[model samples]
Target: MNGSKDIFSTIFSAGTFQMMLRSATPVALAAIGGSMTEHAGIMNIGMEGMILMGAFFGVLGSFLAQSAFAGLALALLVGILAGLFFALLVVRYKSDEFIIGCALNTFAIGLTTYLARNYFPGDASGNPNLPELNLAFLDRIPGLRVINHQSVLVYLTWIIVILAWLFVYKTPYGFWLRASGEKPDTLRTAGISPKKMKWIASVLCGILCALAGAHLSLGQLQGTFTDNMSNSRGFIAFACVIFAAAHPGKAYLAALMFGFFEAIGLRLQGFVSSDLTGMIPYLITIVMMVYVVVRKQRRKMKNE
Candidate 1:
């Protein structure tokens, strides 16, 4: 009974909920951005690279400028440039999106690693850690403890998610974006350029993915940009985008689901073998992917 109580307590702890939100923020942000590209008929497999670039530059800017806001701005600028470069490669040069994406990932990792080693050897792991901002008044409120002791960026992510949902579903521009993907020829006939829509989507994706990176490095990890710190969150975000069918709201839900399992894994780390605990999230992802594939197959069969 004592063991059972302990297990239950761990599962329902405030710490666990906090971990879930922290883990979910980056994935949700990136998924929202990726959804934009998918809506515009672009498969942006370079999201990981964009995120990696953002994380690296975020720390670099913060270290150089000694200000978090300046760091974030610099990261955003770099992210936009990366997006334009990706667009030029796939859209203008007719390069294969998959190959270009792989190249971009490699390029980002190599370039960032080189820069870190040469310019900021001490910060090779990232910049000085970011401090958590707490809402003091909110902390005084009973049951609002969860709302305090969190980075300001985490709160901002929630706002971004809501705004993304509104942008995708409640506006004429959203309609144009969807039309570009579902019926590009029609949109072109309507005098809306599909290419331009795709470009916009690409830029939007870059910005959001960069924010996701910023959240990971600055908000959660406190300004530490370790080599390959992205750790495939970009891919996980892609999976979230697909699982949610490219809807921002649904993507956030999917991300939360991933976060829940990730939190469980962290909680179980001391109780279970670290190796086994580490496998939980990946295993869950595989199961979810299999389920998605099976559902798609069944739907196709029904149509046939």
Candidate 2:
């Protein structure tokens, strides 16, 4: 009993909590981007591809420029181009959005793999890693250890979340985006172009998703661009957006829940089967999606 208590206590400690927050940051950032696209009525299933491209290019940029910020800038630029390509396929040509998304995912996987193999070669890891924002002075204060030694990007993510919330709820552009999804005709009548809103949303989504990928490859891992490194984080981000009904603030919370599971999986790998542990986040996503469906059905029945 004492041993079991100790194990549980260890699992619930402040260090564990910090680990969970760190794990959740990337997912939360990507989910916020996804939420923006969903709010504008665009189903961006290409998030996985965007993330992959970002990770690949981020490493490439760092390797070539030998600067983390330059790498991030390059990733963001590639993401914008990718977003524009997606917009051309889905919005302009009216290609099947789902098909285009899948193609993008496949293309990203193939292209990144080829580039890593040919150009970068030899593990294809990033050159210069982004530095952490260590606040050693804050360590003098009691109970501030957890907040002091985090990466600068993590703090930036927090600020982005708040700003995203405000952008979605308090700004006119946000209103137009929401209207584009819920009532496109109304927006058009009001002289707001739904296509333009969706384009902007797609571009912004790409930038944010790129940042998330950069966080994974540059910020957290510190230089590694493994194939499929994103590992369906894009899908999980989509789930978060759905779970939160496209609300940025709520989507951030949902992402944290997923991140918590991921953190648990990482922590439990030593004690449990790593395969089973890794499935925790995906399994939880399936369960949450089912719950949403059931709740919607029940509400429909009640209304009827």
Candidate 3:
């Protein structure tokens, strides 16, 4: 009984909350971007590729320039180019989004691996770290003090979530974006080009996914870029978009929920097999996806 109590307490500790914040930020950022494209009628499965590209280039830029800001700028530029290229194929040429997405993912993996192996030799341990924010006053607070020290990206993500919610709910462009997915013909009749809206979505998605990747490599991992380091977080962010019904705020919350479970899994490492512990968050994600599918089917049947 004592052991059980201790375990539960440890799982719910302040350290876990910090871990949750760190883990959730990248997914939340990516999911927010994914939600934008989803609302604009684009199924953006290529976020994984965008993220990996950012991870690789972020480190590369930082290594060469010895400046985190330069690294971020390079990552954003790459993201924009990638997004534009993706938009050209999917929106302008009307190619199948799924095939392009798969191609992008494969290409990112191969290209980054090749580049890292050839150009970025040696381990990633010596990379420069992104700066962390320290708010000394938070220590005076009781339970919330854990949030005092975190990556600057964590705070940035919070601002992004608020801005995204406003953008989706309050802006004229947001209305057009949503209408492009649900009623493109109506938008066209109103003199709005749905294709343009899609292009915008793709570009924004790329930039956001790249930012998320930068956060992963630079902020979360402290400036280390490993091949395949993204580790399916892009897919998880896509799932978050679907789970949240493409609402930015809901997507962020869903990401936070996933992050919480992941934090729990990390805490369980000593209590359970390392293999089993690592599976916890992913297993929960699968269960959540299943649940979402079943619920959707049930609603459909009821409506029928």
Candidate 4:
């Protein structure tokens, strides 16, 4: 009973909530980007590679310019250029999106790993910790104080969530993006280029995903760039988009849920085998995917 109580206390502690938010932020941001691409009829699996590139370039830029802002700007540019490349292949050349996505992921892994070894050597390129803002007033509000002392990325993620939701549901462009996926013929008849809509979605997704990667390196990990630091969070974000059915707000919530599990896994490391503990998030991801698939099957059957 005492052990149970201790476990409960630890899990519900303020530190846990803070960790949850930190873990969730990058995933939430990437998921929001994934939602845009999914709405535009694209299943982007290259997000992992995109995230890795962003992390590498973020550190590289900081190392070069000695300014976090400069690093961020460069990271965004790299992400945008990567997105453009993807758009050109998928939209213009009509390449197989899946093949291109896989190629990107492989290329990112190879390129980043190579650069880290040759240039950074042991991932010690720069120290570019994002400033953490303290919201002391929230301390008086009990649990709300747990959210204080977070990085700018945390707040930015919430703002992006709201904006993404509004853009997807309340804006004309959102309608066009959705229509392009649902009925390209109808969109074409309306004199709108579905390809153009795809380009916008891909570019936006790249920027957001890059931001997510930046947060991983600069904010969450405190400006430390490791080879493959992204570590499948991009894929998890993609899962969140699918679980949320392409809704931005829902995707963010799904990311938060995954983050909670991730926090739990971190906490459990002391109590369980490290290998088993490491499997927690991936296991949960598989379960979530299974649940989504089962629910979808049920709905399809009912419709039939």
State which candidate has the highest lDDT.
3
What 10-residue stretch in candidate 3 is worst by lDDT?
Answer: 272-281
Better-scoring candidate (lDDT), 1 or 2: 2
Model 4 scores a C-alpha lDDT of 0.86
Clashes of each: 3, 0, 0, 0
Worst 10 residues of 2 by lDDT: 265-274
lDDT values, one for every candidate: 0.83, 0.84, 0.87, 0.86
Q: Which lDDT tens digits does candidate 3 get at residues 1-304?
A: 9888878998899999999999998899889989989999989899999899988888878888888877788888988988999999999999999999989988999988898887677866456767888877888889769887888888998999999888888999999999999999999999999999999999989899889988888888888889898888889899889888899999999899878878888887778665666566567767877998999899999999
TM-score of every candidate = 0.92, 0.93, 0.94, 0.94
- Give the Cα error of residue 35 in candidate 1, in Å: 0.9
Instruction: Give lDDT for model 1.
Output: 0.83
Order of all candidates by lDDT, from best down to worst?
3, 4, 2, 1
The residue pairs that clash in candidate 3, if any, are none
RMSD of 2: 1.8
Residue 173 displacement in candidate 4 (angstroms): 0.3
Over 4 Å off, model 3: 277-304
Where does candidate 4 clash, by residue pair?
A: none
lDDT score, candidate 3: 0.87
Give RMSD (Å) of candidate 1 vs. truth: 2.1
Question: CA RMSD for every model?
Answer: 2.1, 1.8, 1.9, 1.8
